[model samples]
Target: MNFRRFKIGYRTLKTAVGASIAMLIAMFLNLDYYSSAFILTVLCIQPTKRKSVRAVYSRIIASIIGVGFAFVFFEGISYHPLVFGLILILFIPTLVSLKFQDGFVSSVVILLHLFDSKELTWSLLWNEAQLMAVGFGVALLVNIYMPSIEKDLKSFRLEIESLYSKIFHEIAFYLRNGDSDWDGKELVEASEVIEKGKALAYQDVENHLNRRQNLYYLYFDMREQQFEIIERVLPKITALPVNISHCYIVADFMEELADHVHSGNTANKFISKLDEVKEEFAKMPLPKDHENFLAMAALYQFIEEMDQYLHIKRSFVGFNMKKKTASKES
Candidate 1:
């Protein structure tokens, strides 16, 4: 059985439960057009808490404006087809201007209720308001306890770190041996991991209303910037016409870096070591031929790129410190 394909997601389960509860409550209260509550519940349910709350507020305001328009168009003029169409034309633009376009469908539902009645009364208005309250209220309650994606975010972090480590190791191997049979799969995999991590991190940000920034999101952003440097250096490293004595030193440094791939800020130490490498390169004998000269130039550029990569990591030191301080205070 391919039950995996048929598996219901949390959002789906929430929508069904919330809609049912809303409809039941409306029916219990003997509200007119009780089924409309189900529609609102289904519409109001959103993937994140902030979105759900925003949907509720938008719908409530739009529905109120819709009722006002209904009163003016239906009662003030007449309950006719032309008047209904006129209300839609004016109402849609008004909602769009107010940035309540998300609530258009809910407002239309309210308009239809008035259209069907042929007349607006206090009792009917109260019934629709209660329906909105029941439906949107149930949606809000169901969405209050969103399942945390912390575990998924953590998994992505570990995967990105692992891919980065593999990439660094491969670069080191190429530098040391002057050639490799490597298919460059790690570069592609690391890019994909960082992208996926960023998406999940952004989703995590959307799930929390109070969160102005997510540490995981910032971490993925930093990695993405670092990955771009890695991509630029890979070709430069591989295209070297000849490997100099300095290549082995750089390879050793890369190997140490690969082994220490972690979430901590240790890039300053590597930056110091890189400065020492640069001094050693300056002291070494000049390239003997144009080919060796080109190779040394490429290696120098590679070193510059590596410096930029480490600097990117180093920049996160202040960010992490602030995050730690906030954590302790909280």
Candidate 2:
């Protein structure tokens, strides 16, 4: 037993050391010596992995253009003076702001710096190109290996369910208590939290294409819908309160919807029930007071939208009866 324990501890230590070394190697690869890296870093902070690809590609293209321009302009200038520096300082930012940022644009500026020194040549441009290509390659490799957006779909389901539950409880609070004076801050807070969850979910889907590549595109598309829900209801979150028990009931169904998604147990009947709740919430009486009614209505609509979004998200997981049956039958 003592020998076995020693062996296990050695293996564990070896594995831990190996993992730490691998992580350090990854970080080293991501570091850069070029000014272009700064700009590329900015462009690369996309919410999705797909956008990372686009940003890197853009930077590569830009670098070539900028470098080529530098080469051409350097050959033409006779004297390196304050004039050359001043001219490019004003020109590059204009190009970046007006058009997409390109690394070649910066290369061109670098070329200008070399122009006055009269040391630039085709070889110099070639070296710069090599440097940029390496930087881009490093970025791509780092992102592919360790995407910041990766999350297990199952965990995302749990997070989203928790958010939906919170929203439901907030709605229930208003409905059961009929607190007209109760500001809708809780609902707003829930919306804010859901928005964060949506963003995180979308990002996770994007970064780990291997995990849920089929839903990657849908994740981005659905975020827009979720944001729309937030926007429509956010302004009402702080408004005068009204009786929204009915809305809370609908919100409860939305929480149930997330459960259905997780359990992979939602049937046509559940869907119909959801639809019924949605309809009831939609048709429920509103306050005669325009402000209170409108706020309540906004909250109701927001929950309805969430229900619709959840439905769409579930479709990817095949939560519908038709798909679930097919899955089960298979």
Candidate 1 stretches greater than 4 Å from native: 1-4, 317-330
**TM per prediction:** 0.92, 0.52
The superposed Cα distance between candidate 1 and the true structure at residue 228, in angstroms, equals 1.0
TM-score of structure candidate 1: 0.92
RMSD of each: 3.3, 10.7
* Model 2, CA-based lDDT: 0.51
Query: 1-330, model 2: which lDDT tens digit per residue?
Result: 355443544324433443344334434555223444433343343445566676767666655555444555555654456545654675477457846454444455445445634766666555555545544454554455443434554455455445544544554444455453545554555445555656666566666656664343343344345545645554444352654455467546644544443343544545567677767766767576776677566665665665565555445444233653532100
RMSD of 1: 3.3
Q: Can you write out model 1's per-residue Cα lDDT over 62-157, one digit (the tens) per residue? A: 999999999998999999999999999999999999999999999899999999999899989999999999999999999989888889888887
Candidate 2, residue 172: the lDDT equals 46
Return the top candidate by TM-score.
1
